[model samples]
Target: MPVPLIWLIAALALAGAEVLTGDLFLLMLSGGALAAAASSWLLALPVWVDGLVFLLVSVLLLVGVRPAIKRRMQSGKGLLDPAKALEGKSALVLDRVARHEGQVKLDGEIWTARPHVETDVYEAGDQVTVVHIDGATAVVAKIV
Candidate 1:
């Protein structure tokens, strides 16, 4: 019945949904709602002010804090291994790579591959290096 209690309940529900979905968005809203509940309790704010505070805090947490957290989590993770370095990592061609058909290989295990250039075709059993990975396919250049 009380505004503070309603905000608290909404916050808990959002947090519970976040746990179930494993998405970070709901958690941000939960934080905002909790802030609103606190404001309601501390200042005895009107319902509209509580709602406004919730919206502002939710946007701030999602847009500001979420990105910072994501950056910290992703930081220091390079796209490629330093040892492999895209220069000389060996791969075996498992399929004929045409301009559009692409290639396949066992890069540790079987993987779909694509040649770097349409002009550079490769047959099965051809040794290649992993120049880059594009989506599900490995873009390869001919070895030797």
Candidate 2:
């Protein structure tokens, strides 16, 4: 069989395994194999070069793309909880935010906010960093 055909067969097998495993890992490898098949068809590269390409593409997908895909799949809603996702994000104080109570415009929506530290306070228009989500409130620290 041709090199490209072999790679395509490998990709098909990987995809089938992915279906059975229900994990995206094999899907990523399948994507790499597909890429290798394309390279082999277009460039007629040597077997060793095709192998290197497969490895590089597979590693990139596994390391860089898999986490985001997995997170989306696992979150069910396609995203993490808003509060958890907003951790460490910047917000603009819309009201005097003290340790007890206040409001801030976080990612365009107003949220009940509190200072992360007892002494920290934020006046309207000040920038703050979201420290964490405490119940429905955002615990924030001044950006300094």
Candidate 3:
């Protein structure tokens, strides 16, 4: 059996496992196997070189690509709770805002607002950054 054929079989098996796992990790390994097979067939590289290529490609995909892929896959989830998603948003103060009192337009809706710092005061039209959300109120700080 040709080495490339063996690599192709491994790639197929890994990809099949990926289908069951749905986590993309096995898919990355499948990609590495495919590359190894291609290198073996096209370059006619030595066995050690083909194995090295497979290992290097797999490591690269796992370390560099996997995290970004996971982030892209996870983005915009957990919408049922707004706390983690709403933090760090910018808002426009629509009313005088001080400790425990104010209103701001956040995400196209007005929300009760308060300064994150007790001494901070924000006037109408001030741009503020949402630091935290306490129940229905947004804690804001003036944008530097």
Candidate 2, superposed: residue stretches over 4 Å from native: 77-144
Which should have the higher lDDT, number 1 or number 2?
Answer: 2
Q: In candidate 3, which residue ranges exceed 4 Å CA deviation? A: 78-144
TM-score of candidate 2 on Cα atoms, chains taken together: 0.53
Question: How far off is model 1, as Cα RMSD?
Answer: 5.8
Q: What tens digits encode model 3's per-residue C-alpha lDDT throughout 1-144?
A: 999999999999999999999898999999899999999999998999999999999989999998999999888555456775789999999999998789999999999999999999999999999999999999999888
Task: Assess candidate 1 and give its lDDT.
Answer: 0.82
Error of 1 at 16 (Å): 1.1
- Which lDDT values do the candidates have, in the order given? 0.82, 0.92, 0.93
lDDT of 1 by residue, 9-102 (tens): 9999999999987658999999999999999999997999999999999999999998888778679666665434543567877778767775
Best by lDDT: 3
Residue 32: error of model 3 in Å? 0.9
Better of 2 and 3 by lDDT: 3
